[model samples]
Target: MAGAPEASPGESRLRRVPPAEVEAARMEAVRRYDILDTPPDGAFDRVAAMAARLFDVPVASVTIVDADRIWFKAIHGLEGVAQIGRDPGLCGSAILRDDALVIPDTRTDPTARTNPLVTGPLGVRFYAAAPIITADGHRLGTVNILDTKPRLITEADTENLADLAAVVLDAMELRLSGLRLLREEQERRKAEEEARTRAERDTEAITAFATTLQRTLLPPALPPVPGLELACHYQTDSPRDVGGDFYDVFSLGGQRWAFFLGDVCGKGAEAAAVTSLTRYTLRAAAQHHDDPTEVLDALNSALLLDPSMGSRYCTCVFGTLRPAPGGGFSVTVAMGGHPPAFHIQHGDDGAMVVNGVRPRGGMLVGALENAQFASRTFHLAPGHGLLLYTDGLTEARLPDGTMLGEEGVAAFLTTRTTPDAGRLIEDTIALITDLPTGPGDDVALLALSVPLAPATEQTAALSTARTLATPVAGAARADQER
Candidate 1:
């Protein structure tokens, strides 16, 4: 089987092994590090250059053994990219042996004599390769050195190359570790930002839901009393959660009814509580007085009793309505420095307006220990109307720092006097909306019109109509009631 150990001494040095087993070992070594087709790393390049200088070789490389190729992570003195098939790379074959293989003269050896790197491109006549083995005894690849001119390599040179080969393997491990740490840091930052965004969106959604619930707390519909047709508009200017503008209607004794519209000075649940308390107190107090002045005085006392009323107060208008023999009504209105009422009358010309004779007398509710009340009596005949409103509608702000104004309210009514109370409100609201900007406070409107009757209705309808309507169409004084 040994075949006479080759007749010449040069042939004896061939050291043949089974070709099939040798190729299998080369493939096994390449797969151990699991690095293939990866980019060049700085750590490996450092060791490769060091190896060239330390060993005093013409070339050095960190060579990786592939199934059919030897890929270079780094190279010195090689032409361009250092990747070639397994059979051409002398380092790939040298890996099969345990010790370093020094082919002092490749031209004298039959195995490497015809190698293209030695006979062609690299023109190599001398080659020495030391396997880069990990601590676990896995042969990852090789640290190889080559020369174009044949020369003798002493034992000192070979051992130095072997020690440097170990250093290259250690550097490759450190580079792999750093890449993993950077990936983990990126993932942590992404998760924190996503959590913050979710919390902000949830807060906004809950606030809007609370506002819709607050609007439901108001009276959904107003009752139409005979001899008088009443319409009211109560709306919060901002939906940032509804503020405290509220109104109520409940029956009192002797065919009379009690009604009031009021606004607390703040927003949120605290102000809403004040609005609720004022509404019920006015209804309860109406039992004692068909008079508007007495009802407001009782409410003022009730608010003073609440412990939180120290710095808080409300502005309100309380009214009482009684039916007359004819199709008309009389209203006694008392105000606590709230806005004045608007009244409209119909004539041959068209529907006309009258400003309130006087807004009633009182101070901010609950601010004083004993607040005085004054009353004004007015009559509403059939085919006439009265409008009582909160300041929100008149005080809506424009971007120019000018209020939407009492003048704007008058202009709105003169242009559109529709029969439907709800439609009149929507139209007036559109005027506020058309403005480029508006106020921080809420808006409310209450319009009461006398219903027209069948022809047998009244002979005095024309003359009585003039006394019924309040002329809000006139310019209101700046300090009148708003």
Candidate 2:
């Protein structure tokens, strides 16, 4: 093999060893590969083995040149040795050259004759190495072949050695890229899992707060009233949100008690705030004013005074129940743009009659500066009941686009055979729940009834009073303009 051309003394002055700064940069680039001192890889082993067979050399190695040492990444025909000193080897000098370094008969070559690797026990006579250059022009290592005996080599052999060096560099780059991608994928999955865990914890906290707040907005239990049986039920369309509909049966002291059911315009925290204010205001006003109409007027004024209640309004039925002389109760109900109250009466002949008691001219409360409400007085005898509810029941839509309107609800009540307050509420709930397309809005029901006793002489008079005091359906409209 013919050795690489040597530089003359004058040319050698221009070809000094790389400066300290340049060598530091080259070493840094080598470290970036992270392949130094690593275990043997099959890909590199194959390349070294191929170079030895192709060139018919006794030894072939894929060597990385560090600052002071030459490390063998892959070696063939070399046993139990992984590295050698850079001062005694050809690979270090090969990395400094831009082209392949070839030397035949090291005993005669001036550069090779001084190398310990050539003059020592394992006498190396012929040597060929290709520099492994990085993309940025840093030569970090070499793929070299050596023979103990001098031999002749063709130009094609030198070219083939350079090609094998390229293969080794490509394998290193491919491995580093795959490792980077895998690390990135693992980091992405870890971030996603953390986000999901945070969301679950947040949802749980919100649900607990909503439930506790909803309980405060409604009555814990209906207040017990003398001679009157009361039952109520409330349901929401979604568990995630707090419903705006509210109902309460609270005592105003003595035999007299106040009850009201209403629905705010929207749902959620804002509506919930309004609901809390409404329930507190109604109870406070009812305690001072015994009249239901006056109580509603107080609410309208409070809502109007608070400008924060922007564009928010509610439909309500506020009522006061008091025991009437002779064995029954008299209820004065005031309506504020709410649905009609259902009255179920049992006749002397045992036939049940259902009537809707609605006071017209009632406008939405809290909507205008001067909204009017309607009030009506009715007598409830034994076996007679009154039902008040929010519009969620009547406005429930069926699959056919038809609503369970006032008529539909009245029909449902008529089919029941004289149910008490509790049974009446349960049956209505069953009807609302059984709809094929479930109720889209929240439902609230309040039922008040008098217990039935055996037929007595006072029964006839009580029955007559209830019939004569029955509130005419649009009676309030006459006073609406006032």
Candidate 3:
């Protein structure tokens, strides 16, 4: 710290205020900002860096005045006194100037050279001080530059001081914005954690009941289709983390069993709202249009009525598993923003699964007024098993936060294929279950297998199954009628 040149006898270049008045005004302005005695931050440190470079001074600082001391939020080439005695600070001198105060030579000036700062511990000789003003024009303090040797600061250095002060204000504003977002995120997490804790402590009572209700919302049991052995297994990452992940199997008026697996975008109640709406609507619309594409189209049309629902969308695979009139099963599936289904066929040694058709999701739900989906047809060979899963299974993160990607799913089916759904569900959650705090999403999978029947039972099964089929009375909403 050093004293600045005093006004000459005849003409004063720097704006001057009474020492007492300046000190009092400084205290009020600094307190108004409420940035006193705070921790160091990137925003404040950056001002010191810029000042050092722009002024070519060894020491640059943003100093604030409290009751009797000057505190430095940012300091360069200066240490020990985050706070200093208020008596003879170069910065205190700067606060008196509405503009900057530049002193080229301190030794020749009687007022500056005689001051203790010039001859005492600091040994400062050259100095520049620029007032730090609030938006309302109150000078809080100063951002000053200092050097040990006597030298002049250029006109450019003087001009940049005001500009650098403005930058300090902008930096402060940015820091406030970051703080606001951090608070919002923290509050949201706290609310969620409290709800989760409450739910976990009472699992068997309310938790079990909620799980039962969620289960009942699915089809009561897999539809008794003619030749298809269908069973679905769904397990969430955590019990209380219940979400809108569903697998359903229902009849489509004839030999067809319409099955689907879908997951709503978010977790908790909002997701469940959209999920419930989609499930019932798809079921109800099946009466009119049993095609997978048609059901999704109807769901899309329903969701678009909500404008704030850009956050709402579902990834679903909707398809029909029918005992073909002549042979195995004829499957026609359409996807809507969902992952593709994998089919495992019988090989000589064991069963092998491959993605015969790519992961396809037609139009993103709620994207526009009208979005379309196209359906694809394929044949399921004898003893083939079909698996449809949500991204929760594929993107499941491990303890290290790595995702269980397609490669991991591929390895699971290489040597282990059985009564499909149960094994699949067990393996999927094996890595995910232990994560109490994690990237938890819902897992919904449907497994449909058609085992080869003995010669005697084969002939009678298809005919008897057709006899069990209920006829469609109406076209519209007919698919949902069942």
Q: Among these predicted structures, which one has the highest TM-score?
A: 2
Cα lDDT tens digits, model 2, 1-482, are 11223432544322347788889999998999889899987657767876887788889999998878889999999899887777645776687777787777888887778676776788888888999988898888999899999987888777778877876776677556445545655665666578987666655654554555566567665654656667776767665567889888777777687889999999976687567667766876786688888899877875664455677789899988878887677888899989899999876676767888878878888998788888989888778888888888898887687999999898888888874776787688778768887676877788877877532222111100000112112110000000
- C-alpha lDDT values of all predictions: 0.62, 0.74, 0.63
Per model, state how many residue pairs clash: 9, 0, 10
lDDT per residue (tens digit) for residues 1-482 in model 1: 00011223444323344377655664565554456777876446655665676567778888876666778888876758767776545765555556676778878977677777766766888788787776655556788787888878888677766765765665555334334434544654565477977555554544454454454446655653544444555456555454777776557767787777778888765576566556656775687566788888877776774344555688888888777666666877888867766556654677555555346456677778688877788776676666666677788776787886777676666666543333454565566667776444666656555566623232211100000011122111111000
Q: TM-score: which is higher, 1 or 3?
A: 1
A best-first ranking of the candidates according to their TM-score comes to 2, 1, 3
lDDT of 1 at 221: 55
Q: Which residue runs of candidate 1 sit more than 4 Å off their true CA positions?
A: 1-201, 398-400, 418-420, 454-482
- Candidate that beats the other on lDDT, 2 or 3, i.e. the better one: 2
Ranking by lDDT: 2, 3, 1
In Å, residue 398's CA in model 1 sits off its true spot by 4.5
- TM-score winner, 1 or 2: 2
Name the best candidate (by lDDT): 2
